[model samples]
Target: MANRIHPTAVIGDGVELGDNNDIGPYAVIVGPTVIGSDNWIGPHCVIGTPASDRGAPHPAAWHDAPVGDPEQDGFGVRIGDGNRIREFFSVHQGTKRPTTIGSNGYFLRSAHVAHDCRIGDGVTLGSNVVVGGHSEVWSLANLGLGVVVHQHSRIGPGAMVGMGAAVTREVPPFTISRGVPARVTGMNVVGLSRRGVSPEAIAELEPYVIQGAGELPELPAELAKLLTEWAREGHRGEH
Candidate 1:
């Protein structure tokens, strides 16, 4: 089926939009961008814009340069299928590589995704949530309204960030985080259950959750592996 783009919507050169897209009035889609099928792009939303730091000076001189050819330059936004990007949402293109959003994501009104961010499938960013540049939000992670995630941080899979929280560190999988600096509150029991995680698995992950953000204890193979991976990534300063 053909895309239903509103008459007032502005689609810039080099923009690649797939079939069955519904682009609302006044939505601006700039090119070097790839948007897949069945996306509901709301009014006043902007996608594939150049990074905010395009004017900042760097030793390589490429940092301040404008996006010339999106495809050739390999700098743009890549959105997968079935996303609902609501009104006033703005997603910036990558400065070097492409900023990517996986399938079935929901970005609520006024949510902003900065340059070079990686958003996984089934993720939900509530209204007014701001994800800084180069952040990675894993699959099924939910950020409540007004949440602010620091740049280069990693939000693990099935994590739930409370409303109005400021996340400065990496959130573990199936965890609930809140407060100003966003400390781990507990295991995301409800979230895990909703995801169909077995009671046994939840039990297996309980000890680490009780221990909080510090050193984790030895756990079952799967849980231990995940915690170990998170620890290794944490040591690399990704938080």
Candidate 2:
């Protein structure tokens, strides 16, 4: 199949696009950008472009840093296959490194992934969600609308960040976090089950649900026994 770029779109020099990508009307894509196959870029979305550096010399601002020389090198955006970036969603290329979006991820309308953010596969960011620069969202994690993830924090695999939550610390795997400071409500049982987690693993994980600790304490004795049994029984690959 041939590449189809809308006549109103502005595709910059050195940009690389794979087959069957639909570039929306008036959307701008600047290079050093590489977009993979079957991705949908919605109308008026600006990609692979640096945010305008408008702040004064704060000594810590990206525009004032010493690494600013060779400006565009090592800085741009790379998106994998089958991702959908919706209308008006602004995804900026990195200032110091590449902004990487994994395959099968969905960015809803008005969602913003700031520079240098790493989003893993099958993740979904709801409308108006913001991911700070340098933050890592692991595979299959879902962030509800208006969630704010601080830079440098890690959101673990299969985690769910509730709407309006502010995450400052690491969100553990298979859990749901909500509220202002983001407390864990419970295990992400539905998410785990949908991914085919074994009944034994769920049973194994059930007894150690201690509060204040987001996940099970590092393989406690009872949980470990079940895990060992599950592994020995050849059912360790579901989740």
Candidate 3:
């Protein structure tokens, strides 16, 4: 299972490619980078560029780390197995630390994963999505096309961010977001069903809850407590 690097690709020193990877034409991979098995890096994608050189750091840049690392090469990107990174997507290596993407994530065309981000498994980033640095997108989260995640916010496991949404704060698990500022519309009903979440559980959660972001404060303490319990359970249940 050797890697397939396109003739036009520029693979720099310290770059490690795993088995069966496809490096598309004109893709640039600056090193100290480690890409896992079955990765599809599409055409014109830039991987592991030195910091400072990437130009003015975005405001969400600190979301990756505290910043101010003397050497840009000190930052690196670590991608797990089975990821499909589409054309024109850019995944920046970490600054002061390593940016990590878990297994089974899909990045559609033009999606951006900034420095120091920690993405969990089974995540899907739609076209033109932008994930700010140092952000944490938990497992099973689906970000819609053109969604913009602010720096340092945590996307809870199983969250669904709708297209064109601007997410400034954390999105709790099993919630669906859509709006200018991205309000939670409801639970991810379809997602839950697909995953085989029992109907009784969904029914119980739907009633004791307020559906939107603003209403989180209004949810009953008992429900809030239960949410915490459920999250703990999920953590323990992960494979």
- State, as a TM-score between 0 and 1, how close model 1 is to the true structure: 0.83
Candidate 3, RMSD to the unseen true structure:
7.7
Model 1, C-alpha of 187: deviation from truth (Å):
0.8
Off by over 4 Å in 2: 51-72, 203-239
By lDDT, the best candidate is 1
In model 2, which residue pairs have backbone atoms overlapping below 3 Å?
none
Ranking by lDDT: 1, 3, 2
Consecutive 10-residue window with the lowest summed lDDT within model 2: 56-65
State TM-scores per candidate.
0.83, 0.77, 0.78
lDDT (CA) for every model shown?
0.81, 0.73, 0.75
How well does model 1 score by local distance difference test? 0.81
Best-to-worst ranking by TM-score: 1, 3, 2
- State the TM-score for model 3: 0.78
Cα deviation at 66, candidate 2, in Å, is: 19
Instruction: Compare candidates 1 and 3 on lDDT and give the better one.
Output: 1
* Best of the candidates, TM-score: 1
Model 3, runs deviating above 4 Å? 52-74, 206-239
Compute the lDDT of residue 104 as modeled in candidate 2.
92
Where model 1 places Cα greater than 4 Å from the true spot, the runs are 54-72, 207-239
Total residue pair clashes for candidate 2: 0
